[model samples]
Target: MKPSEEKPAIIALPKARRHTYYFLNYADEFKSVYLDTEIDMSEVKRRRDKLKLSGHRISYIVFLIEAISRVIRLYPEANSSVKHGMIPQMAVYHRIAAKFTLDKTMDGRRFVMSGIIPDSDQMPLEGMQKMIEYYRDTEADEITEFANVRKLQSMPLWLGRWIYRLAMGNLSRRAKLQGTFTITSLGHRPIQAFYPIISNTLCFGVGAIEDKPVVMAGQIAIRPMMKLSLAFDHRAIDGALAADILTEVKKVLEFASESDEASTQGEEVTPVGAST
Candidate 1:
């Protein structure tokens, strides 16, 4: 028999299906929320002072972790994973994985930090503060160390794709591991904001805080505003649920401010007629 006649015709899957198969496994659903608040660095500094008296550093990461923990508690479904064409599965680990940029050299790389929040429910605000300080102080060396360990790791684009497929397929089943959510503060970059990408996991973007006028207690006040975007796989979480989670996060941040105010008021008072 002729070779052409003996060989069966090769059929190709639809473009969408193939694309889905290729990217969906790694694709994470992401959303962002833009928060405009009258809060500024000065306010944060003042609040930190109060928190410091209470033995805490009210850093940015601390605020983020606290807010994210609340969000996760309110909308546990957001902490889910998309695996093997099955329904999005919820993860028990209330942790968040974030990417930290290491270097800007020719091969500028990023490292992923998993389990930032140890125990969401039980994590004291001070613990979150310390974690942020640790990361800020050591992220440089840590990323370098991690990169060195992975220095020998290299794969062709096509091969990497295949590996991703296998990992997202059967291998993921064996581990059955996923975080509650993924948070990226890429907005830390000066000009970048408003990323509308989706991932297999829920994602939130923390953007640069800009100056804007906002109403606080019926008074127009200038506030440092930041964008918060939360993207989730629509398949895993519905719009209402996502909104609920974001809303809860907002409440936490606002509450933090109120808490700071109350703490500041509780400090030693200066009597009206007392001399210095």
Candidate 2:
């Protein structure tokens, strides 16, 4: 065939798998909830400074994940997913999982794929930070869920498009590959609260953190503030439940600076491995 007339590449998925896109396309509406909260990061800042001196490193994402775990533990619905069915039943997960994507360099080009931390409600900030760093550096392997995604990306553009949508769009498959809840961020760049897309049942968008004045102990004081935005599947979660979940998440984050002995709000959570 002539170079210009070359056929588009095609990699076929099993009939059973190809139907995944059908279910994913059923989601009709997504509701976004915007939350603005000011946090006291004095303790976190102090710890970060010390950790840098010791050659250990961490970021707000660690604290964000830590807080996320606590909220998922209490709000079982937030950890749940809507089943891909005629009725679209809601499935509440006994274990909580949070998903995110990290940038990776492959062939000198940037690649991003889904990642998950299962049973996240049990992991601490330190553990979450370490996990994030590990995923960022690791290649496609048993430890890396992006291996299949990377493979799919290698196909011809035309073929990759059909397969990618069918594979990633399938809610069931995505939850299995990624997680029930998703988190994405533009890093620490934007100041105003940004509304993130509601692709999954629940999602968190991390915004910039800058020094902003806030009321503390009846006096205005400057504190490092960050913006967090949430998107929820209206079919799976109602506004009241979503609000409660967001409130609890904020509480966990604000109190993240406390010691383990001081995290008396709820018992700590653990990471649950991959699940279908």
Alpha-carbon local distance difference test for all models? 0.49, 0.63
Q: What TM-score goes with each of the models?
A: 0.61, 0.73
Q: Write the per-residue lDDT of candidate 1 for residues 171-264, one digit (tens) a residue.
A: 2331232334556665557743644344434666667777778777999987766667766666566776766666656655554555433222
lDDT of 1 at 193: 60
Clashes of 1: 18
| Alpha-carbon RMSD, each predicted model | 11.7, 8.0
Estimate candidate 1's alpha-carbon lDDT, on a 0 to 1 scale: 0.49
Candidate 1: lDDT of 263?
A: 25
With candidate 1 superimposed using the best TM-score fit, by how many Å does residue 147's alpha carbon deviate from the native? 7.1
lDDT of 2 by residue, 1-276 (tens): 799999988955433232233323433444455554445556656766776687767786766766776767767767766655466565666766778766655555454555787767676556667778778777744445555655655565556556755665555566676577888777556655656665567888777777889988899988887777777877777877777766666665555543542222455533232132
